[model samples]
Target: MGGDRDEGDSRMSNLTGLSDDLINAMNRHDLDGALRCYTEGAVYVSPVGVGEGRDEIASFLGAFLTAFPDVRWTPWSRVVVCGNVLITQWVITGTHHGPFSMPNGEIIEATGRCVNVRGCSLRTMDGDRIAVHCVFYDQLELYAQLGAELVLPRP
Candidate 1:
């Protein structure tokens, strides 16, 4: 039983390492590098939407990178690993000097705009690969800070 537990731990470590590598790749906008960390049938769910398979994930990231050329993520704390799951907290900082496409199909250029967003992710690993990932963040706060005019509900 001890040996089995050790093996599980080893697998968890490998998975956590893979997740770290993926984050690094994203910080660098290395699409290929990031894709390498995902399993062939990996799935990603973000506040924006869901992406199934590596190809879709690559496409989704590519579009975002194109809009935010200097996007970066700063890990705020060490990753917490458990079995095949890993949780990470991070802050993403980026400039919106280019055109951004909103989920409502509006594309607008935001010059000199900057955004600092706090986020967290839950990832499930298959061996050393990411099989599924779900990311959460405050989209409203991000947009508000980005200078979007807000309309509040009247009491």
Candidate 2:
């Protein structure tokens, strides 16, 4: 990925191995291995917030891994690569046996309940490493599985 390609080009690239390595590292609960997949300036965006670089990403993932010690992200769909970007649909499953930190600074203690949620990750590749990683998932689904009550008006 030397230069940026036009979005209208729609030509797909093959970066499956990069994503595979990352997912496998995460499944193995290897923080260092996962971190190595990203560049030092990589940006990881999630429902929580934006992780500007490797250190921030590490902290964010550290909390998540701590909360879900046995978490695993299983691919539910084929890997899609567009130019220098990679997308993967996944089903993450784990048990809540530790404290989970929320984006808004709230901490939810372990309820001993298991969670299985469908999500996706979009990554921008910079050669052999990821320059950006964005995560998508249902926040409500996670809370509902944990038995948290929330009332909001539908517009």
Candidate 3:
């Protein structure tokens, strides 16, 4: 009853704290610190691709940090948790100062464009660590902000 509710509340607090820590690490471009928030065998997925395990996850995130050296993630008003899952909406602001690789094996050289993109993530926690993290954002929004023109192939 009362005891169970207390435990549940404490668990929610811890999850929220973890989410904050992750965002802080990303804001600082602290790759190691960010990796520490996930389990050893964690899986991360985004529009770019999927990464399994710490090494793969590191590579995926490291690229973004490199491309956007001054990237910052600020929570966009809401962070909700239901059981072991945490959902967060965020805004990423940064300048393109390095190569950004595309999912289709193409690289976009630094356009020197300042980008402000809104995104969200869903994290499933296994104990204190994130076991699975999936991020959602519109690629078109990001690319348009970067001044990229979309070219359609003739079909």
- Report the alpha-carbon TM-score of model 1 versus the true structure: 0.86
Count of clashes in candidate 1:
0
* Model 1 weakest lDDT span, ten residues long: 101-110
Q: Tell me which of candidates 1 and 2 scores higher on lDDT.
A: 2
Best by lDDT: 3
Pairs in steric clash, model 2: none
Which is superior by lDDT, 2 or 3? 3
Would you list the C-alpha lDDT of every candidate in the order shown? 0.83, 0.84, 0.91
Candidate 3 at residue 83, lDDT?
77
Per-model TM-score, in order, reads 0.86, 0.85, 0.96
User: How accurate locally is residue 55 in candidate 3, as Cα lDDT from 0 to 100?
Assistant: 99
Ranking of predictions according to TM-score: 3, 1, 2
Q: What's the CA error at residue 60 for candidate 1, in Å?
A: 1.2
Question: What is the RMSD, in Å, between candidate 1 and the native fold over all Cα?
Answer: 2.4
Give the poorly placed runs of model 3, Cα more than 4 Å off.
79-81
lDDT of 3: 0.91
In model 1, which runs have C-alpha deviations exceeding 4 angstroms? 1-5, 78-82, 152-155
lDDT of 2 by residue, 1-155 (tens): 53445432333433677787888998999999999999999999998889998999999888888889999999876555556877889999999988986667678899899999988889888877899999999988998997766756799
Cα misplacement distance, residue 52 of candidate 3 (Å): 0.3
lDDT of 2: 0.84
Clashing pairs in 3: none
